[model samples]
Every structure is written in C-alpha cells, then in structure tokens.
Target: MVTQDGATVTARSIDATRDWLERNLHSTSIIETERFGFFYGREQALREVSLGIPIDGVTAIMGPSGCGKSTLLRAFNRMNELYPNTRAEGTIRFLGQDLLKADPVAVRRHIGMVFQRPNPFPKSIFDNIAYGPRVHGIRHRAHLAELVEESLRRAALWDEVKDHLKKSALSLSGGQQQRLGIARALAVRPTVLLMDEPCSALDPKATDRIETTTRELAQELTVVIVTHNLQQAGRISDHVAVLLAGGVLAEFGSTRTVFASPFSEQVADYLSGRFG
Candidate 1:
C-alpha cells in the first residue's frame, strides 16, 4: 500500500517508522518508565507500560475506561500507594532517580497532582493556595501571600479571585474551584504536574480555560495529563500515549502523528470512536 505522501507502506516499514519515532522523540525526557507494572492486590492495573514524558511539553495519556490511564499518571508521584495492597514493578525514573523507590512525600512535592474533580480544602481561597506551602514549612505570612498570588496567577485565577481571597473556596464555581486546585498544586513549586481528567467534569468554557492554563504551565514545567477526551488531547498535548484496555500501551508519539497516522490498529479504532 501507499500513503498519502505517495510513499510505499508495508508492515515492516510501519514498524521501523514507529520505532524510530519513539526512540528519538523522548531523548531528553524528564520522566522515563520502562517495563512498568502496577497491581492493586492481585489484579494488574498497568502492565509493562513504557514511555517517556518530555521535560518541556504537555503529554496526554488517553485510553478508554479501566485502561489504567490514571494508574500510570499516579505512579509518577507514588500516589498509587494510597491504596492498600497496591504495588509497582519495574522502573520509573524521574530526573535519573528511581521514582518507585524514592521517598513518596518528596516525590509528591516535586510532582503535584490535580484530580478528576476539583478538591479544594474547606478553607478560604487564600488558605487553599497556601496549604501546600505551609506544609513545606513556609510560615511567614508575607512569603505565603506572595506564593499564593504567584500560584493563582499561574493558574489564571488571580484576577477573578483577587478580591475574594478571604472567601471560602467552596463558594467558587466548578471551573474556578478546579483552577483553585491547580493553584494549590502550584504553591509547592513542583517541577512536574500530573492532571487526571481535570476537565472531564467541567463545561466546554471551563475546559477551554483549563486547556489555556495547561498550555501556559507547559512553558515552565513538565505536564502529563490523563484525558479521555480525544479532542482535548489533540488541542493541548505535544505528545500522546494511548493505552489499550488490558493495561498495554498501544501507541505513543507526537499528537499529530498519533491522531493522523496511528501505528496500532487498536489505537486507530479507539481514536475513531469504534470501540472506546
């Protein structure tokens, strides 16, 4: 067969192309996982998953329900341990450190997480943003204030909540609350941010704002987001990893390449809404 570029295509050629792309795309990755596996008791949620998240761009992990998209994202920061009987295998390296063996608290400090739903503390907006900093030992009021402002600004929420800093965070709209959650995560000054379907519960307008914030955040830190929305992934991700239902990574590459010409039939079918 021949591609639209008029180049002859064969199974061998396709494999070679994909292999080359994978090998070269993540040469300077900030996080690399090799033969990684995760188990919740006896059931494996992730199986031999391998991928590299670049240091300066948004990487979207996409898959159908129960495909371990969130499982892999949480593994980066050791969040999986929150569940009983959960364990990880193989290696996950973050900045050359063995992430699976690293101190969970320190790993979390460097890699912040934003969950599927906005979960702000039942405190004032300012307090919500200041909580992480306080946990990290920033007790000076002035310094905490500065960090709060900076974090909110980074989340694109400072302008809206600037005058309402004393108000309860729960009073904010769903979108605002989500942005507040992002701001709270940023207060710790993490090098990487992991978002698990952050916009899945928001409306289109809210999703757009989060996407904009994500793009801006990518300028300063590595971002790995788990999203089921294919369009959202295409819009915000520089790289995309598609996981199959059985905890397998079916295809991973630049967003353009994966969406336009997936190497795996499973990825193609999933992207085309055939099975997913």
Candidate 2:
C-alpha cells in the first residue's frame, strides 16, 4: 500500500520485489536514500522514499513533471538548500556519509550538476571548463590546459571547438553549449554527476550526443539523471527509478525490465503513453 508515502510491501509483493532486486543487483550503491522526505517550510514534497544508486552506473530517475524527479536529483548534491526554508528528513547517504549533514560546498564539488539548459559562464570555452580546477587551486597553465582538453574530449566537443578555445562559450550552438556544460562538470572529477533534464533543451541530434557522453562518463563515474523522456532513459541508463506523483518510488529495476514489465499499473500506463 502507498498513500502520500512509499510502498508498504506485503508477503506477495516482497517476492516479486526480491526477484526484481536479484536481477538488478550490482555493487553496493554509491548513494542510498531510506524513508527520505523533503519539505519547503512544511509544504511536503517527497515522502518516505527509498532508493539505492549503484556505483559507476547510470541511473535515470524517470517520471512525469511535478513528480519530485528534480527534487530527488537535487538531494544528491544538496542543491535543494538553495531555496529558503527548504529541508529534508530521513537520510540521503553518499559513501555512507549522510549528505544532509555534509558540507554543502564539498558535497557539490564531489557531485557536480548539469541543468536543463546550458549555463556556461560568460567566458572563453577553455576558461569555463578550467574554472572548476582553478577554484580547487589548480594554477599551473599546462595542467589547466590538459584538463580542459580532456574534459572537452570526454564531452565530445573537443574537435568542434578546439580551434576556438578562446571564443565565448555563448557563441557555440545550443548542442555545443550543453556539451560544454557537461565538460565543465566532468572537469571537477565528481564521484557522481547529477543531471537534471540535460537534454530537455536540445534538439534531437544534440540529445543523442549528450546521451553518448553520459554513457561514456558512466564507465568511470556514477551518474544520476532526471529525465521525463522514457526512450532517453532506456537508451542511456543501466538502471531506472520510476517516481510516482507525491514522491513515491513506484518501480525501479534494470532499464529494460522496468520498461518491458513495469511493476505497477501507473508505471505501465506512463510507459505506454497513457498518462504522463
């Protein structure tokens, strides 16, 4: 049973959940949320949600709008604190450390974020990617250059903008700008990257490139993306977490299994385009 809270598993449900868990098992999650809740000054958002995000994997939080997808993603890096009076209850642990109690600045550095739209600073492309390293005290010009190039290559934007490193980042196309955003986040060498609708603003081709970059980055870093696009989730995610409205985690498992055989009626309807 679920009512403005998380699931209440009975004996029958437990067996089905266990079967899915067995099929989806991986290394212990880099992050775990247990009975987690969130609030904006007593206006509750998420409620009693539990999830485990495996290390070095791409886990997509799939749901319709207003389903707490972004809220949950922001919890990873403590980004929700940006709002006044916003707070969380229960626990969101990263590497066994409670992120709610962790230093927000350190947490952000350890887990970078990319937004829905490309948000590059009004600086040269090289400087944008180098800014994170600089803030972390990487001052050597040679080292900064190396990091810049590597980050760009990883984001798949190196060749396109290699000759124009000194140009303003805003001068790039929408797709390039988004890739640059990814590159900037990657340069920080985050343990986990949180992306909130990174492709929502891009065209089809740009979305494809971002998907490719996400997959490649997952090879080395844990990635958690919040996207409403089910096809995109299936294409880029190893595992999927489906959140129902009112902050309930309706279903979660391998991307294929979740998409192929959703655990609940709402999940199945969402997947079938019956209701967002």
Candidate 3:
C-alpha cells in the first residue's frame, strides 16, 4: 500500500477508495480549523494547528507515527469527546458552527466518521443503512427503502449487494464491509465525511475500488482523511497537511506543492526518507 517514487513515498493504502471519491464527488468547503489542540488526560496529543477543508475535495492529513494526524482529524467533529478525560481547545467550525461548543449529537449529524476497521452491524445490510434515518424520525417503509438504495448507490455498493439486501452485513468481504460502513455513514446525509485510514485492511483490487468511489463522492460531500501512506495522499488529495512532533503543522498546501517542495526541512526530510 506504500510506494516510493525516487525520494517521495507514494502511499497507495487508500488510493482505490479515494480515486472512486474523486470521480463522482462534488467539491465544497464545509469546515475550517483555527489553532486547535487536543488532550488525553493531561498529555497533549495535538497543538496549535489550522487548516481549511474544501467542501467538495479530498484533504489528506499525513505525517510520521504519533504526529497527531488522527487527533486533529477527530477534532473536526469532536470525536475526541467520546473518550473519558479527553478535551479539545481552539476553534473548529463546521459550516460556521463551532464544533467544540456545539452539542455532540448535532455535531455528529453534520460530521460522520469511518474508522480504520470495518464494523458493519450484525443485522442485515438494509437495517444497517436504515438505522440512521430511523433514529432521526424517518419511519415510512418507502422512505427507508429509498434512503437505503440511495446511500448504497452513493457508496458504489448497490450492484454488489442489491439482490441480498436482507443478508447480514457481516457476510460481506472486508472491502465490502468497509463500503457498507461508508454507506451507513452516508445514510445520515452528513455534510462532512471523516475517514481514518479507511483502506488499511483491504487487498489491492479492493483498495482501488474504494479510491475510485471516494473521488466520486467528493462531488457532493467534503472529505477529510488521515493517512500514513504518502503515495495515497498524492493520488487522492487536492490539499495535504504534514504534521510533526508536539502536534505542530510542519507544512500545508496543495498536494502538488507539498509533495514537490515541502516548506520545511523536517517535512523535506520525512518525505525524502531521511528521517520522520
């Protein structure tokens, strides 16, 4: 899932899914961050960092291990708040609403997250995708069916499982399960999609399919992804941010620029394989 082009590493881990997103995705700028930081217990996981996420494009967060990439991604939707003794400081605005101050429920409705692992529900695929709409008061059977179809279509999984809507989601392959997870997230109609290394577990062919799906989805939703694969970042991202120790944002710019000419020595070193 990782590739090297001379001095640069082209991360292919999430390339397939991201590529899919780029193709059918619409572009929008739905979130903005300003001087954000997060803490686990008394330890700081992220420091002052700021970035603008375009509404309809893929923005990738990349860095070496323990560089706060995941922590910063969680702040966009306040996912950090779920853990005990976790806190965030600074401003993260999702469509002008401050995430840190907003109700967690409301924030979740606007920003949805997909984890590294595929976690489909034990129930049927139809039920898994319908769960969100049902929770929000959508009860008509017709409405639920429509939502299910649309979500699955958007996730590029309709053709694969259309005939078996009643089958348990766990019956699918790892790649299919991950796409189901995405479809479930999409069922809520979130304005922002946050993915944490979504393709870390799939084979090359499956990964390719997911990348293409992500590119298409970007046409209608904003996406923020945290990935360690540098090649993957370059292939699917319109913008890229490089994180470093102490949660510092070493460099941030267009993917072309960040990969071609990193703004700092540290970023250059990391990308060049000198040191992280």
Candidate 4:
C-alpha cells in the first residue's frame, strides 16, 4: 500500500510509487514540497502532498473541481494566510527556505499570481502595469514607464495598448484584461508566476492568445498554472501534477509521460474522461 498522510492507494505498491517519484522529481527543481498540508478552520484542504516544480518551464496542477488545485497554488505564496483560521504544515522550499515560514508580502514579491478572472484595478493601463514596481519603491517616472512597457511587451499586450496607456484598463476586452493582469504581475519581476485558470473566462481566440503568451513566458520564468482542461495542460505544460479528490497527488511527471502512460488506473480513468 502507498500512503500519503491520510490518503491511500492499496492498488499501488509503496516501492513502485517511490520509484516513480524518484524518476520524475528533477534535480534542478526550483521549488520543492515535502509532505505539505493546508487547513481551513477545522477542515483540511490539502493533505501530505509532495512534488517538485522545475526551475524553468510550465507546470500544470490539474484535477477535478474542489480538488484543492487553487488551494495548493495559493499556498505557494502564502495567499492562503489571508483567510481566517487557516494554517499550513510541512515545507514549501523556494530559494532553499520554507516559503510557508517566510513573510507573506516578501513571498508575494517573488512569486506573483494571476487569478481565474480578469481583475485589473480601476486604473489606467499604464497604472495597472506600474502598480507593483511603484509599490516596491520605483518612484522615477522613466523607470516606471520602462517597467510598464517591458511588462506589457512580455505579456504580449504592448502592441495593442501601447498608444492608449492612459486609458482605463477596464476598457480592454476580456482577453486583453486578462493579459493586462498578467502584465501587472510581471511588473514586479517575480521569479515564478502562478496562474489560476487564466483562460476560463475568455473566448477561444482569447484563450489561444493567453496560451501563446504562456508558452513564451515559460521560456524565461517558472510558471505554475492551475487548470482543469486536460488538453490545455498537455499542450503547454512541461510537467503535469494530477491531484485527486482530497488533494492527493496521484501522478506527476513530464506532460508527455503522464499523458502517454498514467501511473494508476484512477489516473488513466481521469485522463480518459471516464471520471474526474
């Protein structure tokens, strides 16, 4: 039997499971989780999950609804702490220290997040992108302008909004707004970017734009995205981590490997549309 905290899979032998993890857990990992768990008041949201996020490339955390995908993503930057009566245990190492133990503000500066929906501040496009760097103490106009333009360009939003820098960010389309949100996060120059269903609210064309931007961004930054769309994950992610009901990490490996040869029947079923 293989057991992780309270989660168990009797069908998988402990030795086999260990072997599989050893093979997939890359040595160049930038973020490592060790028996991590999170709680909300009296309820447990994540239980004894452990995995490695590579230094560069996109990593998709996928599972069914209410499987703690977003919860885990939030935990990385200690955003979970914003909720009352919440707590986390175990280690989430980034830069060789437990991120859970680090200051939330400091952690957020290094690990930026984009939400499921476009939520730009009711400010101009320039202000939206410049917000983070300004808060971080870049007071010079030229510097802020440089950061804003660089961020927008990095998010693939510069060409579309460059001439309308003073316009309200809310004026953009759903996809443009989402990309604006991404640019805002990038302005802080985070080493890692966390995206939670970033394309869920957009149309196909917008989703395609976001997907393209994501692939390009992965070339320079480590991106950890939470998504339920299996095909999207397969198309963009370098690694895939499948979380089961109750936040159990059932399978994790390169996207190609996991999609091609799932580790267990449950994983196979989940990938095949037989079950979530």
Candidate 5:
C-alpha cells in the first residue's frame, strides 16, 4: 500500500507510484515536448510545438477547434497510431522515457484517458471498472472488488451506486456514466489522466461535478485537459496553454498569469472574444 498526502494513489502500488517518485522529480516535470509536430498523411496538424506538463496538477489546453488541442493530447499516449498514414516528428518525454518510441499499450496503461463523452460498456457498473485491472492479470476476486470500490469512491460515485453494482452501466445517467468512465480509468492506477473535453456533453451540474472531481484527482494524478471553455479552464486549471492558428503554442503559463495577461495579442484577442 502507498499514499501521498494530497494524492490518493491506490490500495496497493508499485515502486514507481507517485509516493515513491524521486524527491527531485518535481524539478523536472511529468512530461515535456520539444519541437513536436504531427501529420495525417500530407496534412500537418501540429508544428514545432513545445511545452511542459507539471506533475500532479491540472494543465488545461485551451483553444478553438482545429488548433491541435486534441492532437497534442493524443500524442502523449500515441493514440495517433490508430489512424493509418498518421505520423509524428520530434520528441515528447514522459519523465525519462521517449513517448514516441514507448510501447503504445503500456503507455496508455500508465496514462489513461477520459473522452469528450461518456462511454461505458453494456456490462454491469462493477464490470466496467474491474475490466481493465482484470485484463492486466489481476484475477483475485477480492482484490478486484477492493479496486473497484476505491476507484469509484475516488471518482465521487461510489455512494450513488454502491447498492447497484450489478446494474448495467448504460442504465445510468449521462453524468453517472462519465464518472463511471473516470472510475474505469482510475481502476488501472495510472499516474496521469488525460481528458479530452470531458464535460462537453454534460449539463451544467454534471460539468461542475467533473471539474470538481478533476481537481481532487490531481492530488494523485497529472491531469491534462483540452477545453474550449475558457471559464472552465480558469476555474479548474493551475496552468493553461493557448494554442493558436497554424498549430502554434502561442502562450503557456499559470492560469492566473495566462488569463490575466496573455503574452500574445492573438491569444488576448481570442480570450476577449475578438476572434478565434
């Protein structure tokens, strides 16, 4: 078992868990991109973009559509590989590992993701959370139960459905399903969680819950979220990166700094609703 004061890691953990990271890890960062670019066939989606994602914090990637927000987010786990003829250039480092060269499946396991919309399986709620751990060779029923319960609790959903573990996940409300997706990701005990517009499809109350859960999750996990809602970014992020036209990383800094004083006129204009 392992735990960090602010982070709720896991009931059991490996040597590389957050609580066991080197004392000086914060001096580096959770991940860094250097001259990163991406392409789908002949079309370029990102270009010469570079930034650092701090560990165990909420870093919001904010931009209008077609600004490469999702492109950069997917690059962290090599999800870009799903498309034929897709390729990347330059490097993305996760701690000491080269993300572009890392094993895709393993990378995804260590850095889980929650999509723009909820996507729970037709299986029971319990099964949705247990599936990932079980697939990774955790067959002990007692351990699976404990993991599912802890994950759901961390996602702020356990009490709502504790007595309905066997109910079909599809039967739950949209907000509940989204929380279930988060719980599913947490059940794998990842160190980082990537959210691609996680609350875009939810109502205001659901969006608030997701934002709240993300803030809490950041205590133990690095969270990178892509958002079109600048207000949401300001509310939940410690840092914000503004991607601009031509796939450029126009500005990046603390949310307070970036929102209060964007370095670029383009970013400032976008923030002020002048133009995207």
Candidate 6:
C-alpha cells in the first residue's frame, strides 16, 4: 500500500508498516490518507483529500481561510469527533491503524496536538507536563519527574523552566508558555505532532523560538503544521500540501517544488498573493 509518489500507506498491519519502515526506514511515511472527506452539519468541509506524512520530518498544510486546512489537521487526531454532526469519510492510517476506527483516546495518545494559542493548564509547570503520564497510569513520582524533564528538554524549554518546575505556568512568557504546551504534548511520548497555526499568537521572537523547537523536534517525531504564512511553511517543511475550497487538496509535493511551481492556478494565486 504505497502512493504513486512513494508515500507509504497506513491501512496495512503494524508489522507490515514496521517492515515497510524498516526497509525504507529512512524513507518511511508515518501517516496516510486515502479519499478522505469531512462534513460539518450539511456543509462539506473537506472532500476526497489524500496525502502522506513522512516520519521524522515536517509536512506543512497551507491554504486559504476556508479551505479546510485545520479541518483536515484535526481529523488526523480525531479532533473532529469533538464536534456534533461532524462526520469523516474514507480512511486515515497512522502507523497502519485506521484513525477513524481506532479509539479516539489512543489515536490522540500517539498523535499529540498543539493549538494556535498557548493553552497551559492552570497548574504548576511540573504538573502540566505530568498530566498525560498520570492519566495513563504512571504514578511513580520519579518516573513522572523524569518524563517531565525529558519532554521539556525535547521541547527546548528545559533550561529556562527546569529551575522553576513548581512555578505557575501562567507566569512564563508567551513564548515559554507555548513551549510548555509543546512539552505537555511530548510528555505522552507521541510519535506524531499536529500543530495548528502555532505561531499566530506569538511575537516574532517567540515565533522564531517555536520554529527552532519545531525543527529540533522533527529529528524524532513526525510533524504536521497548518500555517497561513507561506514563508514559514516553505522555511520549515520538507513536504507541503495545498488545500482549496470544499476541502480539496489542490496540490502536494516536496516543499521546494510546491512553492516554486504549484500545479494549480488557485495555489499559484494564493502563494503569489493575488487572492485567497
């Protein structure tokens, strides 16, 4: 089960997926969608969209405001399930498991998410990072502490907040708080991270820090980011998927190719700043 462009499929067994990854381990895809569609009430938010997200790299989703970029991103982790009358059609495979059929909690555990705004819980930094592990039944204080530290380190916020683990998360700067949000997501040890306009709410410096952190995190995890900023998408992503009205995927390819030569006029127009 592989796409023509060499993107791996997600419907096979885990063993098959593992074998595929091992064989093409350096060329493995972490997630795959085939004819995926989504609906909000009677309105179709996405329609027959398909794409692949490679492992240990960034896949940026770019499109106009109503093109369903975020909708598709949310579907990857079943976040769409939270909304009533929202239905997803077709298959989404993550590490070879059907995301729509899999347990939502389990799907979320393996695919953590970060929102546009920094959403730290109203708790100390220590507790914030420890929340995921605690929910999964990890109660050992030492283990929790180690996980917190490791997650923070991966998120590149350890040095700044390590000394203040017990401090209120709200006390941190906007950039720091965003990193805390990322650290909280990483504490669960997710293999895929979904980011939705993560820098929209931050200042330039904070955005830079988050971008740096995202680059580092890609060394170990699959990253899918939805961003309005075409420049940011070109700068950070290895692959790019451009969406259009009715949630259609207009074009997808290597970052350089997509940005330099889009396949559709819509994509070209949006990228060229002609109109959304």
* Number of the predicted model whose TM-score against the real structure is largest: 5
Cand. 1 Cα-lDDT: 0.87
Worst 10 residues of 3 by lDDT: 1-10
For residue 240, model 2's alpha carbon misses the true position, in angstroms, by: 0.6
Q: TM-score per candidate, in order? A: 0.90, 0.89, 0.88, 0.90, 0.92, 0.91
Q: Which residue pairs clash in candidate 6?
A: none
lDDT of each: 0.87, 0.84, 0.81, 0.85, 0.86, 0.85
Residues 1-276, model 4: lDDT tens digits: 111211110122223434544566535676889999988988888899999887668999999888899999999888888889998888998756678767777778778899999999999999999888877777888878988899999999999999999999999999999999999999877778999999999998999999999999887778999999999999899999999998888898999999999988888999998877
- What is every candidate's alpha-carbon RMSD to the true fold? 11.4, 9.6, 10.1, 9.9, 4.2, 5.9
lDDT of candidate 2 over 108-156, digit per residue (tens): 8778899998999999999999988887777888888988998899899
Candidate maximizing lDDT: 1
User: How do these models rank on lDDT, best leading?
Assistant: 1, 5, 4, 6, 2, 3
lDDT of model 1 at residue 273?
91
State the lDDT of candidate 3 residue by residue for 1-276, as single tens digits: 111122221212234334543454431345678888889999998888887786558999989989899888888777778899997788986655576777776677667888889999899999999987776777889878988999999999999999999999999999999999999998877767899999999888888888888888877777888888877888899899899988899898889998999879899988887765
Return the lDDT, model 6, position 166.
Answer: 96
Quality of model 2 by C-alpha lDDT: 0.84
| Residue 111 alpha-carbon offset, candidate 5, angstroms | 0.2
lDDT of 1 at 61: 97
The list of candidate 2 runs beyond 4 A from truth reads 1-27
lDDT of 6 by residue, 27-57 (tens): 3678889999999999999999988787757
lDDT score of model 3? 0.81
Clashing pairs in 2: none
Q: For residues 1-276, write the lDDT of model 1, one tens digit per residue.
A: 111211111122223433443576535677899999999999999999988887768999999999999999999988889999998899998766788877787788878899999999999999999998887767889888998999999999999999989999999999999999999998877778999999989999999999999999988777899999999999999999999997999998999999999998888999999977
Overlapping backbone residue pairs in candidate 4 total 0
